[model samples]
Target: MSWIMPRRSLGHAISQLLLQFRIVSAVARRELQLRAAKGLFGVAGVFLEPLALICTFLALRILIRGAGEGTYLNLVLWLALGFIPFFMFADVAIKAIGGVQKGGDLYFYRRLRPLDSLMGTSLLTVQIFGTMMLAFVLGVSFWEWEFVVENPGRLVFLYLGIGLIGFGVGLTTLIIGHLLPIVAWVIKSFLRRILLWTSCIFFPIRQIPDEFRPFILWNPIAHGVELLRQSCNPAYPAPGVSAVYFWGWVVGSIGFGLFIYANSEELLFANEPLPGLDDGDADL
Candidate 1:
């Protein structure tokens, strides 16, 4: 009887995990379908928006360097790879922030949880961006030169690490936005410009003057983009960047977000007694 009880408990845990997974997948599929139906471009705007922005940056580079730079196609590939992950992080953070708000009505069911929505939204972002990255690699390999992927596994880790940080910060941001909307808006607005200036996605960080490097070194996204480029080309140098440095942000952001979320689970949505908030927050 005792042995049977232990087996039953384990079975129950497994069943719960399976249920959560199904819920997450369903939500991800639903969002993908809904977003895909939006227009002629469909969800491809996910990639296109970043590409357009990169093109604008490329034009600027051309005007400034006046043909002294490397091949344009090579530049596109480099910037595209860098910008894809950077934008993925940005997009995932925004989606994750709205995960609870967008699916507020769905939380009526006892089985549905705030974390489920977060996971589902996160998974959707991963799917869309992962597909785009893979497609880029395939296009380069099949149509053009041999793609140089020295450390394929490490490259993937660098990409996914950015997403995790986005998700983590997003989870915490959701709580802040719910409690104080105005502050969240301000923070969100400022974060974009900050990330843009610091990430060095389209431009190489080395181009920045030596003394100024320390100012932007704090940005993990910059470290990630730089490290990712290093993984591809031997010529590019990222002396300030390392796997350990980038991994610190990935782990720290996730740990902090999860810790805060666990303690304040009840505050999510409209179910709680007291609505807690953040530094840059909006009203619930």
Candidate 2:
């Protein structure tokens, strides 16, 4: 009977997991459709935001310093790798801050939790940015007439790692911001200004002065970005980046975020009225 009980519990857990996955997938699909509808070129136009940011930065780098001062890797590829992954992380974390509020209406369904909305947003951001990164890399490869991705595994690991970290940070931010709104604004500012500069998007870590190198390396996103470029061109010099350190941030952030969410999930919807309940007419 004991063994049967354990088996039953495991089977139930698996079923619940699959059910949650289906819910999240549905939410992600809905989000994509809504976003695509807003854009002029439908789905294709949704990509233009990131593409424009990358191009603007790439042009600034070329105009200010010429094409890739210290690297043998194709200049466009180098910047794309940095810009694409960094934006992936940034988009996930920043968008998560408001996910609960924007998705409050979703809670009318008994199974749809606030976390599901955030997870859906994260999924949509990752898929969109991941596609953008691949498209840009392939475009650059064809333009340069060379394939530079030496370690495809490493490239994938960094992309997913950065996205996961972003989800975690965004979760943490969402909880704290619900408690105190001002903190969210500060976090957004920090991510946009401080995090962006420290991420090594425009310049490699090798270019940093020795005394300042440690400060930059302290940011896990910096490690992910530098490591990603190194994954493409093995010779691309990455002096102090560590895979273990990067993973440390990934595990720690996710664990802490989950811990906080488990404790404070109620607070997110405590004061806000569900959409259908206010009207007293809507049904799931």
Clashing pairs in 2: none
Sliding window of 10 residues with minimal summed lDDT for model 1: 67-76
Candidate 1: deviation at residue 90, Å?
0.6
Candidate 2 C-alpha lDDT tens digits along 149-263: 8888889888999999999999999999988999999998898889999999988898899999999999999999988888988888888999899999999999999999999
lDDT of 1 by residue, 1-284 (tens): 68999899999999988988899999888777777787468778755655566557657766876544243235555665677788788888877777787888778887888888788878888777777777766676666677766667877888899899888888878777778887667657656777877887656777778898888888888899888777666566676776788899899989988898888878775544444654334565
For model 2, what is the alpha-carbon lDDT of residue 181? Answer: 94
Off by over 4 Å in 2: 272-284
- Could you tell me the lDDT of residue 237 within candidate 2? 89
Residue 274, candidate 1: alpha-carbon lDDT: 48
Local accuracy by lDDT, each model:
0.76, 0.88
What is the alpha-carbon lDDT for the whole of candidate 1?
A: 0.76
